[model samples]
Target: MLKRRLANTDLEISPLGLGTVKLGRNKGIKYPTHFELPSDKEAAQLIGLAKELGINLIDTAPAYGDSETRLGTLLTGQRQDWVICSKVGEEFDNQTGQSSYKFTPEHIQFSVERSLKRLNTDYIDMLLVHSDGNDVEIIKRFGLLQVLNDLKAQGKIRATGMSTKTIEGGLLALQQSDCAMVTYNLTHADEEPVLDFAAQHNKGILLKKALASGHICTHAGEDPVQASFNYIFAHPGVTSAIIGTINPEHLRSNVAAAEKAILQQ
Candidate 1:
């Protein structure tokens, strides 16, 4: 497996990362029904598998119901071996069964503290601000950039970034915040400019929805998982892509694709 250096950070992560969105709730655009909410035992197995397969990064968020908890349960004793990236500014309401977005500084702090508890780690490797398309207000109202920097100084988080849905949002975030940024590849090819900017600025770029919610490989005749992995690896600016798979076979195949892609590179 190939390791890429995160911009402005000491972290070096594998190109393919494990995403835990599906492990929590299934409200996204193209939710997979192949797996149920993973138990702590299952999450431990998956984390161990990911480590053996050379995957270094795991992405989860507070909005992902029980995902942080499960990750915490699996990774409690092995904190130094993996790069765990989680998000703030969004909370999952079990009663409503929906995600509620809030970006106030207090909320950000509260979310981080809660995430720390759930992940069972003292410090998060990377912390991203969950976005809802309104970048300016989100930044101003939350004072997120400053708060994240403060947390970094306090050693609660190593790095900070935003998880945005639009290229415009990404670009704006890059200009305003010194932290890294994440975006989905499927709906926002318009993000090429932002990606170029990040590369030039030496900022970390994490990719989500690289599989287009499994639509890309599903549309192609090739194995959807392999195709999705290969497509993201073909991009130069992508530092890492998050993939969620519960089936051991599928996970192994995805890892194979990642290994082959690295060999080809």
Candidate 2:
């Protein structure tokens, strides 16, 4: 339940955010184990549990199937109590069963508008580009940063960021936007520089895949979840770790581990 004020924004986010990927999309994921999508009632209960645990940040995306719409229905009257983060670059196609990436300024605006309507909210707390690799090229050729800046200026989103796949893109995202989402866990330390940059520059850093996409292969007697949270929150730049889990007991354990990690810190 520890909070950090995200840089370049007025939002105060919890150290562990509730990632809503499993609430919607299930196919074509890289998670270690196949998952059954949670029911609407289950998801609503999960959302309530997350909020009860004092998690203020909810991460969803257009690429996450109907996550935004589910949250819109589930979150109903709790809009003012949470900071919602959605994405622009990639969209999930239910028919083709695949995700497509588009970042033309036209598409960017269109995505923002659609997200606003889907989320049943007037403004997004933050918007990130869901990258499909080629991150540097995407930023250089697509005018994504400018378009997101424009959206922010227009008050459609409060902040802009990129869920980057590489170090170069992470660095570029931090330089050009309010935050960057990067993968950082015990097995992967390559993205630490992005976190270091975020710390040095006072930019926000949202850690993705911190538990290594649920393929957390740990030695006997080692608690991967606790260890992952400990390693992540040890870094000052980590604004939050976006963990997607629908089970209430798993959520409770994660929260307890996160609290312990913060207390130890």
Candidate 3:
């Protein structure tokens, strides 16, 4: 695996990181039946396979129902080697079948503590503020950046970042916070100025939704996986791309894309 330095942090993460949104539930997809959650045993085996295959970064969020818990259970004794990036400010309600965002400082603290407990780790490698739309409101309501600074000082979280769905939100986060930024690749590519701004500021950039919600790889000979992965990897500012898959074969295929990128680079 190719390793890249996350901006202003000591952590060196793999170019390909695992996103756990699918591991929990098919959030945006409609299905006749609820998506089956992976068993703990299977999750553990996959985590082991990931480690063995040189994948060092695993990104999860509290909003990803049971994902953090499952990862925690799987990674109980092997926490030191992995860069476990988790998000706060949002959670999933199983009964309501919806996600709710919270931004109070109290709620932020509560969320982090719960994450720590669920992750079975004392400190997070990278803690991201998961935002829905109101970046300023969310930042002000919780003073989240300040809280993250305090947590860093207290050694509860090594670094902080923001995961946003908008270019405006990405730029605002970069201007206001010293932490890193995560955003969708397709939207970001369309807003090159924001990406350039982040690069100029030395802000770490992580690309999510790299596969365009599976639109990239839905047809024969299209190979959206490789195309999307390479597109993001070729972007100078992007440090890593998060790709999610439950199938081991598909996972290997994604890993092959990363390997190929490294060789070409």
Candidate 4:
């Protein structure tokens, strides 16, 4: 349960954040297995369990179906108790299982406004551009980062960032924003520069796909989740890793593993 300030922001996120992808979207995901959506009661219980287990950061996005709405209802009165990290730019359509991206300033503004209403919050703790792999083009051409910063100045968002795909994009995001989300785990270390730069420049860093979207394999008698936590938390640059799951046992286990992993730092 190690909490650290997310770069220059006031949000103190835990090393392990609860990802709400499964809480909202059950289709068009990259997980190894398919599953039914959890009941509202179950979803609320899982989120409460995450908070009880000392998770302070909760990652959600508009693309995550109704995650923001569920979280808003669940965390209603206890808003100040947790840090909510939501995204913009990319949206998902559950009916057709199709996702669309728009990085224009107008879309960015609209997305933030909609997310604020959906989450029932006046201000977002963290906001990231849900990239579509065209990271360079988005940053260079769209000027969405400026819009996020403007929102930050307007007090609608506390921090700004991008969920980048390429290392170059990751580095550039660090230079321009308060944080950047990158893929880093036992399987994928190609984005280390992003982590390294974040560490050096005092920028926030969040790890995505740390468990390889639940596809990581382990050796006999070894724990895959614990191994992933150890690998991710050992890095000082990592602010948090977004792990999406709806199981209470899995959340407890991951939190325990993360607590142990962070102690090593």
Between 3 and 4, whose TM-score is larger?
A: 4
- Stretches of candidate 1 off by over 4 Å are 27-29, 32-34, 176-181, 184-188
| TM-score list, all predictions | 0.91, 0.97, 0.91, 0.97
Candidate 2 global TM-score: 0.97
- Model 2, 16-87: lDDT tens per residue? 899999998888888877889998889888988999998999999999988999888888898998999999
* Reference-based TM-score, model 4: 0.97
Q: Name the regions of candidate 2 deviating beyond 4 angstroms.
A: 217-219
Error of 2 at 98 (Å): 1.4
Which residue pairs collide, candidate 1?
A: none
Looking at model 3, residue 204 earns an lDDT score of 75
lDDT of each model, Cα atoms only? 0.77, 0.91, 0.76, 0.90
Residues 1-265 of candidate 1 have per-residue lDDT tens digits of: 6788888788899888898876777654265444467676787788889889889899899888878887787776789999999988777886677777888888889999999999898999999898877766787766787788899889999887888766677877776554445555544476677788887887778887777756565564666666556656666667888877766677787789777765665
Q: Rank the candidates by lDDT, best first.
A: 2, 4, 1, 3
Clashing pairs in 4: none
Evaluated at residue 109, the lDDT of candidate 1 is 90
lDDT, residue 81, model 3: 80
Candidate 4 lDDT over residue span 1-265, tens digit each: 7688989887888888889989889889998889888888998898888888888899999999988988889888989988999999998998998899988899999999999999999999999999999898899999888899999999999999999999999999999999999999888999998999999999999999988998884434679888888998888788889988888888888888888887776
Q: What TM-score, to 2 decimals, does candidate 1 have?
A: 0.91
